[model samples]
Target: MTILCVRFQLPSAHETAFPELLGLLEEFTPVVEALPPDGALADLRGAERYFGRGAVELASVIRVRALALHGVDCVIGAGPGPMLARVAQRAARPGVTCAVSAGEARDFLAGKPVAALPGVGAATARTLCEYGLDTLGRVAAAPLSTLQRLVGAKAGRELHEKANGVDRGRVVPNAVSRSLAAERRFPRDELDPVRHRRALLSAGEELGARLRAVEKVCRTLTLTVRYADRSSTTRGRTLGEPTAHSADLTRTAYSLYEALGLQRARVRAIALRAEGLGPADRASHQLTFDPADEKARRIEEVADRARAKFGPRAVMPGGLAA
Candidate 1:
């Protein structure tokens, strides 16, 4: 079975949005590993039979769907594993699919730059190139002891194995989701915490709905604020308990925002991530004595139902940004 990694070079416009692209991959297969904005890795072991086509055909459908729905073209690469597939996509043009069969995974990787190997950054690549190990083929052919002396024992060993096209990883289909995150950037920078908080709430609400849909609950949440100056801050907290409740997630997100004490930070965008996910059925909910809390939850459920039928804006919380 081959793993196919689909790399979508989203236009600069939609580079920061994740949810829409995630939804698109969910249509092809639920076992998608989202790489955010640009790419995704999908385990296509079972999809071949289900889709009645080869991996290439499956890639074609995904590419066409993305272009039609979002105006983004996808370049897909299929190989025996994630590393090979990802590298293959990098060699492809937009809207094209490249397949590297298991037999050729090694040969295809050989001549590529050593930096093409994952985790080999510029510094590491330059260090390797200094030793005349510019291409992956050279790294793979070099003695393991020599590589260790040049880079280090740990990084050298890993690079040698990867350059030789060795990846022992398997697609983890049922691993408990680690987190749910969403972010949006404006066409123009805005410096209003109120607006920022609204976007945060919107993201939390969407994440909560997704958690419910997936039958997962989260026990922690994180908020990241990106400023126009390329600076950012991230804050996180454990929740009272695991929950897929939108209202609870929003409250936690709001608290995180308040803690930032932005005061007058020029914020460009905001992101919310619900982490530590587990089966919703296994989560224990705390009983609430506050009438307002109960009332708000009930209203939230009603809003969810209305949104389900009439669209997301059918109901909105007070103070929502226009």
Candidate 2:
């Protein structure tokens, strides 16, 4: 089956906002696999007869549609399989399409650095270079038994096949639900922890409302803090129980921020992501004995209904009011 790998040049500030683009791709093919932030792989074999176009032509069509509709340009690479498609996509220029024919795949990969081959790590490249196997051509010419002795049995066999431009892996599509993320960027570098907590609270409230509105709950929460110097730190935690309640989500967000212990760090932005989402009906909420907890949940439901009718600004959490 032919596969097309498309890479998007998304701004880092708005990287998580691509649901509309994904929906658009779904119209052309059902086998769209999201690569998060900036890439996707689509299986185009079935789309050929349906769209009356070849793989390369279909890729160009997708690029044009994305540019016209979303104001986003894409680089697409088309090949018979996933590996070659990925390589072609990386080699493609912005707003362009590149394709590797079946016959030319080997020569295309021949003289590239060993590190350029997928699944070849820095340490592996260093080991190979020690033996003067700096290019894919040399690695491909190496005996399979020799590669196995150099690396290992499984990895060596895998690398040998990849160096020869052979990939047997299939493109698995729609494996997981897309995550929801909310980020708040400070106008200036702020070092106060109280301000950081407040920002996190707002982000949590926004994320919780979004999840509840869709009737979904997340199993994990990831917190990312971008510093003034452009460096960032990320931490994630899996909840004991999945929930879409604002209070529960806010509490988890607070805990994650506190765990970082950023006493005087100049923070630039904070982002929270709700991951591993599933249907709310399928998740089991733990029963609470505290009357206050029940009261809070009841109030949350009422607020959600009011917001649905009036607007999102109709209700606001007490902490967020300031």
Candidate 3:
């Protein structure tokens, strides 16, 4: 095993401390790449020789340190490459290190569903499965030309390579992002659409205020809805332009919620995450001629000033004023 995929089981309250967790991985390998919100990819090629320990052993140490020092637990997967490592990690539970040896890579992946492979979205998986190529083994055995004809040339080649355990992907060294998240939990399982929409509006308002306060703009917004059954659905939308505006955030959130087509879902919580963040000065807003739009922005600026002088709740959206 040369690569390790580590995913932390972090509490929502500690989401901001994700960078610190990335630093912890760096102690073991300088090749740690931060996967924001709660995960990381660490290449242990140098560390294995330096520490005289296998990747799985080092993963155990990482798990222990994260729990003992930060009171957080992590699941890890170790493999010969990044793609295999990521696939292994999904099958691992907390406190476990699911390691796939080089010799066992093909056998390990053969039984998994096509969707289990990274980059194979629901639509693609469905298309492949319809033709009896539901498993990695089936995909690997299919004729290259046949596969290409089915999913197009480029996607076909990549799919075949992954199925055969050929991962040319590398762990890129990346810094932690300025991701911001906010969540609201209902007192009881909420089945009301009106209440859910209100919660989303409140979350958007909070996210916008926080981004403006930090002088940052986000390029995308992600919505996660947790249901009473403990299952969840998540979707992300990229904005037309980077923004720290409440209206844009709310509109994106609403679009995502509507796409879910939830019919009386018992929702326990709603969370919104703003990602791809950058300096507000470096971002641009589209030029508009609408007087109403310009007026709204002016009013928003005044409200921001009031909130800064008084308190966070001093100026709030009408939906959340109560």
What are the per-model numbers of colliding residue pairs?
0, 0, 0
lDDT of 2 by residue, 1-322 (tens): 2788888767766465476677556545546688887788887764564334688888888788788877788888888888889888888897668888878888988888999876789999999999999999899999999899999999999999988888776677672445667789899998989889899988887777767766778899999999999999999999999988878888999999999988799999999888877778999988879999999999988887776666566788777786
Instruction: Return the candidate ranking by TM-score, descending.
Output: 3, 2, 1
TM-score of each: 0.53, 0.54, 0.54
Cα error, candidate 2, residue 202 (Å): 45
| Candidate 3: tens digits of C-alpha lDDT, residues 1-322 | 9999999999998887688888677555546678777999998865564345779998999899898879899999999989999999999988889999878888899999999998999999999999999999999989999889989999999999999888889987685544667788999999999999999998898778767765678999999999999999999998999998998899999999999999999999999988887778999888899898898889889987777666667777888877
Candidate 1's error at 228, in angstroms? Answer: 43
Candidate 3: stretches off by over 4 Å: 177-322
Compute the lDDT for candidate 1.
0.76
Deviating ranges (above 4 Å) for candidate 1: 170-322
- Per-residue alpha-carbon lDDT of model 1 for 98-184, expressed as tens digits? 888777777888989988886889999999899899999989899999999988999888888888888765555432245556676
Quote the lDDT for 133 in model 1.
Answer: 96
Candidate 3 or 1, higher lDDT? 3
